[model samples]
Target: MVKTTGFRVLWPACSLALCLLMLTGCPGPGDRMRFDETAQVSQQGDNVCFNITDARDYQPANMGINPRSTPSKEKNFNFSPGLTVADGKLCIPPSFYHFPDKGQFIIEYLLISKEYDEPRSFVITLEINGGHIYNVTPTEREISLPYCRYVMDNSVGTCQL
Candidate 1:
């Protein structure tokens, strides 16, 4: 026969509470996440990483990492600004508007994405401190993604969780 003390009985409950706290500490459904990344034109060697503080088991999707060249230049031109390293450190230039010998190279864009429900809008807003820059309304999105989440073939949008 063994005598069990109160420590044994409370240990499980304390463990459970700790686990729950850890799990809920991060963003769950219907939370906004911010990504600090350098905006660039090309996908190759691009380092536009999107991440949230203390997050796992989730990812970003359908971000319009795409920007078209202004009509003035040839179809294939790298006018948009990209994050570059200067003095052995990451540097984001003052503007995304750039062209060879040309003043400000502007890219006119209207962003859109498939409605995601978990987010209620798949809401992703890109805010550039200097330069300027979604679709899927907050209301329409909340109801859409959850309905199509398990459909296998997602037409509205895509997300990994």
Candidate 2:
């Protein structure tokens, strides 16, 4: 009887340890957002241009402003943002403005998904310079991209989870 009880306790502990180890070694969701495209912006006397095609293409679901926070008890699992969905992608435009004095900006992208009765929240940050851009994942780790900056300002407001 004592041996059986000890086995039961040890089994749970072993399972938990294995789960933690797997999570630590696996890449996170933010790591998946790192695209392999040139994100550089060229400026010609105040004219700036950059292509967001790669980023837009692999944009993970719920990675936008006003994502669906509540799950519906009825109907198919259709999600809706507070505003209209544009081209099947929720558009959360950058509100961060880089003034001459402001060298850095922290943009936040809140991701919320409903499962059963609870909602999950994930936050992503983007660091931007005049011609440089970096992506910060939900883990708060900084990832430097070649030429893309996420503009996060007051205009990029928060949504409740």
Best by lDDT: 2
lDDT of each: 0.31, 0.35
lDDT of 2 at 88: 32
- Identify the runs in model 1 with alpha carbons over 4 angstroms from their true place: 1-4, 23-161
Q: Residue-wise lDDT of candidate 2 within 20-107, one digit each (tens)?
A: 9887776766555442222223233332223232232233233232212222232132133242222333333333222232133322
- Give the lDDT of residue 43 in candidate 2: 32
TM-score of 2: 0.25
lDDT, candidate 1, 1-161, per-residue tens: 13466778878999999999898886675565432222222111222222222222223322222222223334333333233333223222324422232122222221122442332112222323332221121233112244333222222234345
Relative to the unseen true structure, what is the C-alpha lDDT of residue 61 in candidate 2, on a scale of 0 to 100? 35
